[model samples]
Each structure stands twice: as C-alpha cells, then as structure tokens.
Target: RPLLKTALLGREIVYIASIDSTNNETKKLAAAGCVEGTILLTEEQHGGRGRLSRGWFSPFGKGIWLSVVLRPRFLPQEAPKCTLMTAVAVVKAIRKVTGIPCGIKWPNDILYQGKKLVGILTEMNAEMDAINHVVIGIGINVNIASEELPPDLAALATSLQIETGQPVSRRELLTVVLYELEQAYALVNTQGFDPILEQWRQLSVTLGQKVDVIGLNNRFSGVAVDIDRDGALLVDTPAGQERVIAGDVSIRPA
Candidate 1:
C-alpha cells in the first residue's frame, strides 16, 4: 500500500536495511542534487546522531530513522523554522498514532513527561542569501520495548509502545509524520513562519519554565518567555532578555 498521501514527501524513498546515519546519506544525495522531498530511510542506524552530536539509539527495526532532502527558497537566516516546523509535524503524528500528548522541548526534541520520544536535526548547506539544501533528520522511538532500551538511555528516553501499552505501527506513524511535515514545510516556506511558530508555542514544553541554555560561547539561566519571529528562543534573564539562536536547553530546578 502507498502509505504516503502527500504531494512532496516520500516521492522517492531510498530504503536501506541498515546505515551509519540516514542524515549523512541524505546529505550526500542532496549534494548531488536529489529532488526535493527525497526521503532516505533506514530500518536501523548504527551511528545515528542528534543535535550536538549526541548518539541516537536506533536498534534494528524498532524505530523510524530517516532524513528528508529539501531545497527550499528560504534564506540562510530563516533555517531555524525548519526545525520548529518539523517538531510540530512529529507532535501531530504522535498524537494521532499513539494518542499520547507529547510536548516539544525548545528547538527540536519531542518529549513526554521529560522523556525523549523524538529528535529532529535540521542541517542546511547554503550561501549567504539562499539555501542549497536542507536535510531534516527525524528519529522516532516507535516500537522499542521499555526494558529493551539501553541502560544509559532507559531513564531519559521512551517509545510509543511504552506510552500506549501496545505496539504502534511505525509505517503508519511515519506516513502521518511525513504528511504533516509536507504540509507544515510548505506552509512555512510559502505563507510565513509565524503560523508554524504559533503551533510550536502551543505544543512547547520549554516555554514558561525556568531553564538554562548553553550556547557555543555563552550560558545563561532564565525563564523561557517566548520565541522571536525567526524562531530564536527569547529568555528573560537577570541581566535582561537574551535571544538564543542555537543552544542546548535544559529545564532548571524551580
């Protein structure tokens, strides 16, 4: 059956049994000028990585490990919207597939009760004004069992089966996610990023919370008040308000 009902996404799916990283593979294809919405999926990713180069645990056929290639007309400065939009798409898919309400943590991590459920990595290659290609890497913990998770990640990660008390279909979840992504992707690139930003705020777990952000050369603790127009995190700190473009955010003890 054709699981995808979208005009753009999954138009050409490169499925592999195993790979080092779907994002890496997709990036190569993108560099060679793969069409927009070319999806590179793998049953298992041996060297999957998340934001900040953190290892993503993808074992065998238990999860959805994939990356989509997009050649959007967005300027380099507007690249942050891709991560925000992708997070919303995954959140919508999780709600429909498992009926579990998951929240997005700042830039791109999807979590439920502080446990990570999905991670989105949006990487782009571009000139100063225009983007060459954007590879959105999405890793969803779908059918991995509770006890089967690695000891290091057991406390901090979760799967759909663990939340729903039954096995959820990865194919179905992936289909819905891709469909939602295509919609959000088009909307953000066409209409504007504000609409998707509003949806991101609604499902945001980082907002209205005391948090700490670690950037490349700065770190600060503050209250996450809101997001800016370009999807930067606006934090209210003791010094003043800080606009964080890319950082590692953790909820601080209140």
Candidate 2:
C-alpha cells in the first residue's frame, strides 16, 4: 500500500504468494461485495489463462499477475470499454518506466517488435440493466529471464528484461500501472470513453494492417480500420465491414 498510493484503484489488496489466477480470485471477492477498488495480486499463477483459455506463462517473481475489481454504474454493454481503458493505462505506465514505445493490438494485447509483452482479460458479473461488479485481469512480463520461459512461449513472448537488457523493478512498474489506471478510470467516469478511444487508436499497431480474425465459429480476413466505443474491432472485409468483439487476431502480409 505504501508503494501504491493511488486514490481510486488498489486501495484494498489481496496479496497471495501463489494462486490459480488473479482474475478468478477477484471474481470471488467481487461476488462477496468487496470494495470497488480492491485488487488481487499474486506472485505466481500456476493455472493462469489468457483470452482463449491458453495457459499464460507466469513464473514466480517474473511478471505482474493481478486483477482489479470495479463496481462501475455503466450498463452491461459498456463493460468492454474497461479493457480498452486498462490497455492505455498500462502502455503509458510501461513507457514512463522503461522508455520503450509499445503498441496495443486490437482489444488489449501489448506488443513490442511483433511479440507479446502483455495481455488483458476482463470478466464481468452484471445484469441486463446494471453491473454488479467487474474483474479485469492484467498479466505483464516484467523481469522474466528468456530461458526460464517455455520454448514455445519464448519465441512469441518477451519481457522488460529482454527488451531493455537489464532487470526491471516489478514493484515500481506495478505502482505506476495502478496510478495510471486510477487516473483513466476517473476520466471515464467524469467524461466518457471518447478520449480513451482516441488514445487507443493512436497507440494501436493493428489499425490499417491486413489481419485475420478467427472467432469461435467464423473466420474472416480484413483490413483493421477502427474500433467502436466498446472497443470492438471494425474491419473492412471483402464482403463488408464486420464488427468483431472477441477473436484471435493475427496480422498478415499487407
């Protein structure tokens, strides 16, 4: 709590040495009517998972594995914007700490040099008209040594140590991330998602690129053009423009 002096987020924390997943933990807390800004932070996640339930490479003391609980008054349909809000916050925090300019993939994947640096997953417990609470999970590869990562993951993932050739202080990075998120959340509550959406578009690497989006039941190819207010991708396909909410997106040859 001393390291993180944020006003809105991280006021209440549940720090665990090891856990299945921070998101799952936060969900339980959120269900029990925990404080709105409570955070679930784990040093290690033995069963961490990402957007498509793919196992996340979260070795102990190498990355940031955490989830934030929010009780926003927004409708259920507006929950997805929180993911967008988090992506911009983390990107800004990373740049401030490491001086590395990273870009955000569609929805909320942070990438550097075409390899994944961070991933965000958001879950909500809401009714049709209102939201009960939300748990947004964020995983960042901070000081993970390259060799410690699995062979399959090392090829497609990176860390702050590998990007900068030196170790990073996870504490400092996590503090900055929470501060940024608090500020962004306050902005969204005061104004709207317009400003954040504009910032997301500016920091987006996927926009204006030819990409393939594979959903649960459909696959399509298109040029990534824009994102909606709710952070859905707006793609111009051969048939027509399609609104993609959640999918496995891969940028292809333009």
Candidate 3:
C-alpha cells in the first residue's frame, strides 16, 4: 500500500468514505470552478450510475469509484473523443501495472476475458460552442471476489482480483491510470485525435468483429471496422451500411 499518485495538474483532491456518486460531487466542484485534475473518490457510491441510465452496484470499500474534472480546450463537438481517450488510458494502465491483458468495448467499458472490469461515464457542461469542463467518472472492479457480485451481474461483470487470482492494490492501479490519462489527454489536446485513435484501435477488441448495436430506432448487426475522429463507430451492415454515434455494442465472436 503505497499512496495513489495522481497527475495533480494544479487541482485539489477530495476523498470520502461514502457518497451518492463521485461524478455528482465532481460536477458540483467543477461548477464552482474546481481546477483541472481535481478528483473526487469514494469507497462507496449510494447511487452510482452507468451508461444508458443503468445503475451500478458499488458496495463499500470494494472498488475504485472516482471522478475527475478536466478542462480540455476543445469544442463541444470534440467531446466524445475524450471517452475513447479514457478507455485507452485505462486499458494501458491495467496492462502496465498488472501485466493483465485488457481491451476496450466501444464507448467506454474495459473488458478482460469477455467480462467488464471497468465502466466510464463522461459528462460535459457545454454552452454555445465551448465546453466549460468535462467530468469523467471511472468505476473499476478492483478487489471483489467473484461470489460478491450480484446474481444478475455475476455473469457479465468481473473484478481484477477474480481475473488475477489475487487482490490488487486500488491505490497503485489508480496512480497508473491517472498518469496514463494525463498523457493521453495532453496528446489529444496538443497533437490531435489521430494518434490516440490509432492507439485505441490497437487495444480494441471490438474491431473486425461482428457486433449488435442497439440503436434508437432499431437494432442492427454489422462488422465493426473503425472509429472516426469524432469517436463514432463505423460499421459495415448487411442492410446497406451505417455509422453509429451511440449505442450498446455487443460483440459476436467468430
């Protein structure tokens, strides 16, 4: 147990034993002009959220539930790319620190052995053409046992301890993840999305795989080919073709 080392980036840090949600706390601080790299972490989240309005199950002291506030100088249109950036950072950090192979499912779920180990939620307060700030919420299943998961999620979700056959230090993993996030964020802000997008493709497990994307109007099946600079998934569908900006992507392995 070493203490977590975050990017710091000139922002203050806040930690709590329990909270409604780290994202909610970070959003409030950001609205009050919290500096970049300000992080809110809690051991438990009473009302944790997932993508698509789903509620996440986070018990006390069993996971890494945290949110980061970032003020990237980019237009609102360029926001989705930040999700991709965070996904890449998480995957890289897991591999770097633990030597465990991990991959990204579209949008922002990190998977290992076809089970989700991480979930990311990104929110932005935008007006006109600019974004005031983005709150990136990251929930990681760190030290839980397989038997600890709820009956419904036991089949689809997994923890790092279950995959590694031993408990991992939450602080260590968080440090690495924050460092990687800062690096990727800087590259995207200074260089562009091309480099990060390329790296994202290399670490992605969904590309070239047949996937079912649950769209607003209807569901469609296609082969995921690539992701655009705007972070939209390009799919080659049988019924002509299409691009998906947002959806629940399910991979159908060959």
Candidate 4:
C-alpha cells in the first residue's frame, strides 16, 4: 500500500481474486475487531449489493469493487454525512485522474453526462447514540465497454472508459480515491460537516431540480432545494417543504 498516500485508509488492504461481496466481507472483519481503515478489495463480486437491496453487476476484471472499514467517532445520525463525503471524494478523484467531470446524485451515486459511473453503499453498525464501525462500499466501472453492460443497464449506467473514450488504470484510480477519502474524512473530523457539505453542493446534480422521490410506501414529486445539516434532502412541494432522509431520488425534466 506504499502507493497510497493516505495515513489511515488503505493501510491494511485485503485483496482477493473474487468474493461474494466486499461489504459482507468487510462487515465480518469489522465484527472480528479488525482495525479501522482496513480495506477489502476483490477482482470480482458474484453477489454484490446496492442500496434498497438491488444487485450490482460486477463482472471479472472490469471494475473496482471494494469496501472500506471506518470507525468514525460520530453519532449514528451523522452517518449520512459520510456518504456525502464519499461522493465528493469519488468525484474529485475521477476528475483528477480521468478528467471526466462528474456530479453526485443525492445520497451516493456518481454520474457522468447524466449516466451513472459510480455507486456507493454505506452501512454502519451502531446504536442510537454510538457507532461501532462503518463500511463504505464503492463500485466504479472503469474499463468496461458500453456494449458489455447488460441490456437493462445500457441506458442507465456508464463506465470511465466509455465517458473518456480511453482506458483508465484501476490501481491509480483506487489510490487517488483512497487519498481523497482520507482527506475528506479528516476534514469531517476537524472542521465538521459544513465544509464537506459545501463541496458536496458544488458537485451535486440533484439540488435545485424537480425530482421524484420513491420511498418504501410513499412517493412524492417536488423540487429539491437543499440538504440539511444531517444530510437530508429538503424538497419543496406544492403543499410545503418536506425533508427526505432516505429514498430513491430521480431528477425530472424541468
């Protein structure tokens, strides 16, 4: 891990040729008292998962599939800020490495030219007021061609290669990602969430747009106005302003 410039993250990495899910493996290690900043990286994931229990497509040697173990000293309610931090880090890394300027869709999806380029799923083991560990799972489609993606995902997903019209080095991209994440994590600890939130806003594509949010039992259409301190999306509806903490957000045509 010498190539990584981060002080804490990626210091101890476990690399495997294939696994069911990096997040699952990282959770197992976290429960066994693995140190914070430990990373679980796999070349292939057979049973990868996304938010809302969706399956992630991870073919062998086509993308970056990994999970990071973090032990942040923050309350359970502040966990969503970590997801925002991750989005900023990923966006910064992609822009720096591949020159593909990307934006973040609320919560944790990275997009390029309105197509998804990266997905992040953050899970935490915590109580009401305390946190034991947090696992940040990230998947970035790097070299996969557009035609190689599944038919269902062809219009919804994209890879770095497709966006930039060139191949990207996964190793270099991962290193830069880790470094950027470390920097953002440090900022959250030292400066609090305001600075990180500002960066998130600048890189966000969801704010100030009409959106439709689908929750478990309810759906609403409104204009996304702002993100609260707790990282909740504030949607301005016809009735009033609504705060959405968790849901699927889709930007609608204005």
Q: How much lDDT does each candidate structure score?
A: 0.88, 0.88, 0.86, 0.90
Q: Write the per-residue lDDT of candidate 4 for residues 1-254, one digit (tens) a residue.
A: 66888889987889989999999999999989999999999989999998877899998898999899999998998888889999999999999999998999998899887889999999999967899999999999999998899999998899999988999999999999999999999999999999999999999999988998877667889999999999999999999999989535434434
Q: In model 3, how large is the Cα lDDT of residue 243?
A: 77
Q: Which candidate is the best by lDDT?
A: 4
Off by over 4 Å in 1: 247-254
Across 1-254, the per-residue lDDT of candidate 1 in tens digits comes to 27688989988889999999999989999999889989998999989998778899999999999899988888888888888999999999999888899999988799999999998899999977899999999999999998899899999999999999899988898889998999998888788888998999999998998987766666679899999988888899999998877645434424
Q: Candidates sorted by TM-score, descending order?
A: 4, 2, 1, 3
Residue runs of model 2 more than 4 Å from their true location after superposition: 247-254
Among all windows of ten consecutive residues in candidate 1, which has the lowest summed lDDT? 245-254
Screening candidate 4 with a backbone cut-off below 3 angstroms (N, C-alpha, C), the clashing residue pairs are: none
Number of clashing pairs, model 4? 0
Tens digit per residue, CA lDDT, model 3, 1-254: 13545455325679889998888889999999988888888999999998767898888888989899988878997888879999999999999877889899887899998899999999899888899999999999998898899999998999888998998988788888888998898898788889999999999988988887775567778889998889988889877767788535434554
RMSD of each: 1.5, 1.5, 2.0, 1.4
